[model samples]
Target: MILAQILHSLFFIFVSYVLYLKYNNGVVKPSYIYSIVFCGLLLFVFNYFFKGLSNRLFLFLLMFSLSFVILQFMKKFVNVFGNNEELAKRKQLKVNVLSVQDFVFKKLFIGLICFYQLLLIWVPGIFEKMMENQ
Candidate 1:
């Protein structure tokens, strides 16, 4: 189960990284990848440390909210060390932007990443318990 969870988290991180790279015109910045992995590890640790909540619904809600909070902090941390060249490039590229499309795609990717992280942490036990109850 631990190995499965790790693999699942890695898969989401890879997919999210790929999506980010694609949208960023193939700019493979190490910071983005690191931040994504760091966020995933953080999520995994959080899930592991707090797995004893009796209320499954509350656990779900907590993980969902925690993902957003953690992601937001990660974004802020990355932005604090933003590269000057990247900032310049972004300014230049603003004229050729697809804001709405990119915005929607980015949000969808983030949502998937969060959802998968939660699933990785909870799905096995949650489903097993549900099946036993039935």
Candidate 2:
């Protein structure tokens, strides 16, 4: 079980870093450090709760695949929205094209993802306690 937890934590960190890098296209900004902090906290919480789950290997594989797919979908969606807006603005200005150079959007997106992961690890515990009280 300890070994399984360790493996799962390592894999989770790896996948998260991969997703962040893919979204930023290998660009490492200062904001990406949140990924490390969130991953660390997530691993600690996951290992504490790890013993309850059976078939850790299978679940880890499933989670990794799902996260990758979700990240790809979100990236595509952001690209479409950003591209469309840029195109509209450029057309109005009668310009050929303009590339997205804003780092704010990517940073905000990554920060939200990190926040969501923290909530995922926390909110269930909160709800479980509430259920016990009732």
Question: Of the candidates shown, which would achieve the greatest TM-score relative to the real structure?
Answer: 2
In candidate 1, the residue pairs with backbone N, CA or C atoms under 3 Å apart (3 or more residues apart, or in different chains) clash, namely: none
Q: Candidate 1's residue-wise lDDT over 1-134, tens digit each?
A: 46545644564555455555655568766776676567556655655675532334334434554464466557656643244565457774553344543564456646665675557355667645764797
Which candidate leads the pack in lDDT? 1
Off by over 4 Å in 2: 1-14, 27-105, 127-134
| Alpha-carbon shift of residue 129 in model 2 (angstroms) | 8.0
Give candidate 2's whole-model lDDT: 0.50
TM-score for model 2?
0.38
lDDT of 1 at 57: 38
| Clashing pairs for predicted structure model 2, backbone only | none
lDDT for each residue of candidate 2 in 11-109, tens digit (9 for 90 to 100)? 454555655676667866555557555754565566567652234333433454456457657766676544576567667443433223334344444
Clashes of 1: 0
Query: Candidate 1: lDDT of 25?
Result: 69
Alpha-carbon deviation at 33 in model 1, angstroms: 13
